[model samples]
Target chain A: MEANSSPLHRGPLIAAGILLGAGLGGFVDGIVLHQILQWHNMLSGKLPPNNLIDAKVNMYWDGVFHAAVWVMTALGLRLLWAVGHRRDVPWSGRTFFGSLLIGWGLFNVIEGIIDHEILGLHHVYEYTIRHLPADLAFLGFGLLLLLAGWALVRAGRTDTTPAAASH
Target chain B: MLKLLATLALLLAATTAQACAVCRPRVEAAIHAPDYTDTLLLLLLPVALLVGGVLLLFFSPTLFSWKPTPPRSTVAP
Candidate 1:
């Protein structure tokens, strides 16, 4: 293909989408699970946070996790800005949105496996004695997200307009 | 090399150095615990996943060999 007519690079956009999605997904997990539901804190598994001091420690770790995700989100935004200016990146809503879903799904899968299963860090709903059910459900949700994201990305394959031209 | 060694020595001394009664146990546990590596890994898991996922997505074109299709006209014929 001619240089001008060459296909846009989807890497940056995909990177942006995944990072933003993971960051936002992490926020949801932190807010909903840690704060609202009180299902688990960052160090709940190790320290249990039954008392004020332990809870404070867990809260500190939670803040750290949130800070890390915030950095990830900011980096994603930076990548999005860079990709938007590039003539080789396609300005497809489908691609961007699809990648976002993929990123979120990837987050759930990776986090769920590492923290929930491998590390025994915490569960989605920790009230019950049998935490496996809740963990399985969380993984199931992740699988659904992955399927939906994959479908959207496949659909986005048809979109070919350069981002610069779209604007 | 001397600076690096000095820094390492300082770090080692800091961990063993006296602290308040309240903080001493926690600090000692963190340093001397048999499972310190496990604790560190657990702490790093989420950050690793976030970074790794982003990198994977960034290089997805090469991994998946994505090809650009021709743009479709929006206007109806």
Candidate 2:
């Protein structure tokens, strides 16, 4: 691929993919837990209840918070794919991996800050001793995504350069 | 094959194990009586967006990159 192939084509496609994937993936939380499993609300068992009216409002905002999570998952997948696809392009592995890690961190941090903290939608630890396994499973999934994304970006960097790469 | 086998084993183990009282009831309820109205709509919203995103990512072609499919004649030959 020529330098003229400039990685410019990546922007909107990647952005759109990330936003969509994150949104959809985040929706899985609400669907599987709240609606399906009926285990509890995503933010439930964590926050103290105010009143019946406030509880309903909290649930409503909880849905919105989950929507934001879905959006972030979209961004994660987009970064992974966009960076992985640029192996043949002139992009460096450092750039790709760095971008992906930063992107994932930013997603978590921003969601944590705005949606969870500021909005008072939920907390980081929303589980009892019995539900520890479930909480850990979700956390593990997140870590795996970040790791896999980083690996792809790192692999792309190495393969793109003739000096570091044999093939 | 190994991954599938491992997954199957895990599934088997999970099934055989005594269920957590609270967890079991919830899971069973979800399977037997899914409230589709409010939940289904919310679930589909994200899924629809994802499908659209994937299509744009892999299939959409630009002016230079576009591969035109053969146009069919209105009348059959």
Candidate 3:
């Protein structure tokens, strides 16, 4: 490559990774927390799932949530494809992975704030009368993700070139 | 693609419709009993914000900066 080669943009890859990461993270939430653990439903706070009918209703909303994340994942894949075709997009795993962490953490933070706290839609663990502890823990985890992701993303800046070519 | 999506849609519809033969209507009724619009908005809020933030970053990652993006190549000193 020439010395003055066009600068490889980091935005696209970051975006792609974030979307992909968040989408997959959302699936984990739906599958593990919502389904497997049965911690809480999409609207468990609003309508407690103490009975069969109510539980199914929550399940239905969970499906909808999954569908939205599915769309996000698809969009991320499309963005990745587009970035691959471009000669000016860096292919740094650090950048991408970092972005993914950011996405997941972002999901947790935003969802934690809006749904869990503000809307009172649900808590991390719904079995107890006091839901603050679990909810705070979830937010704490998200902050940790953000910090880790920031480090990786900063490190990725050193990786330049289309495919990490030697200077 | 169209056919696959159609089939999946049909399957999803079918499964949701028949989860419980006896109380399917009751479940559906209960779910839809509330103001449908409000429920949907609330449910979609998180995903929407998440998607929006990512898109903003994808378009402009400047919000989070590094030591400036390294050049694609450099002439070795």
Candidate 4:
């Protein structure tokens, strides 16, 4: 293909988008569920943080989770930097933001399925007897985010202008 | 750097030496716990999927190779 005709290298953009989204999404889970809501910890179901030692163990696991997400965010930043100068990559805000939502949605769905359902780890709101509804609702919201993100990314496909060139 | 290393070594030694009877079993239980590998995998599944999906999306342009529209001619009518 001719140089001008070559399609954009969307790999970097997509990578950056998803990683950033997942990282931020992970933060939301850590903060809202683990902290504010006091619903659960990383290992609450398996080893409820009832006593000091068990609590310490849960805290340790939570730290591990946070560390993993921090690394993901860093990786996303690196990918964004790598694609910053490339002319072929469209620097559309919609694509990036959309990817973020998708990433977050993906996190919620995956976490909801594996942790809440499959592993029986913890529910979104653990205080009530009927926790399944809350968990399902969380997954539903994640689905909504995925749809919105997908739409935004599709919209971004028409934006072919180089970001730097426009500035 | 040397002081930091010494301090770290001391901390490690102190922690090992100071393991109380009550703490030892809990620590041992945590370390020797069965089925934790499965738990770890479950936790990691979503992260792996997100990373995989993103990579797939990134490389999709190459796999599909959708043709770009030709640039408009600069000449005016």
Instruction: Give the candidate number with the greatest TM-score.
Output: 3
Better of 2 and 4 by DockQ: 4
B1-72 per-residue lDDT for model 4 (tens digits): 999999999888774545455676785577347866876666666677777776676656574234467666
The digit string of per-residue lDDT tens for model 3 on A1-167 reads: 54234545788888888889888888888888998999868889987889999899889888888899999999999888777776566678899899889888888898899999999988888889999999999899988998898899999977765543421
Model 2 chain A is weakest, by summed lDDT over 10 consecutive residues, at A158-167
Arrange candidates, best TM-score first.
Answer: 3, 4, 1, 2
TM-score for chain A in each prediction? 0.93, 0.47, 0.93, 0.89
- DockQ in order: 0.21, 0.03, 0.30, 0.30
Residue range A1-167, candidate 1, lDDT tens digits = 24245645777777788888878888888888889977767667676766655666667667777888888888888889887887777677877888788777887888788888888876666656788888888788888887887788778766666676778
Comparing 1 and 2 on TM-score, the stronger one: 1
* DockQ score, prediction 1: 0.21
lDDT tens string, model 2, A1-167?
Answer: 23323322333333333454355545655677556764445345433334443344336545655765655565556555554544333334443444445344334444444434454334444444454455445555656656666565445433333111222
On lDDT, the candidate that comes out on top is 3
Of candidates 4 and 1, the better by lDDT:
4
Q: State the TM-score for model 1.
A: 0.76
lDDT of 4 by residue, A1-167 (tens): 24347676555676788789989998988898777876667777777666767766676677667778887788778777766776777777888898889888888888889888888776677656787898999899999999999999888877666544545
Identify the CAPRI category of the predicted complex in candidate 3. acceptable
Where in model 4 is the C-alpha error above 4 Å?
A1-3, A163-167, B1-36, B60-65, B71-77
lDDT (10s digit) by residue, model 1, range B1-77: 99999999999878453444566566455444686567657766777867876777566666433455433552336
Q: Estimated TM-score per prediction?
A: 0.76, 0.38, 0.83, 0.78
Interface RMSD of each: 3.5, 10.3, 3.2, 2.7
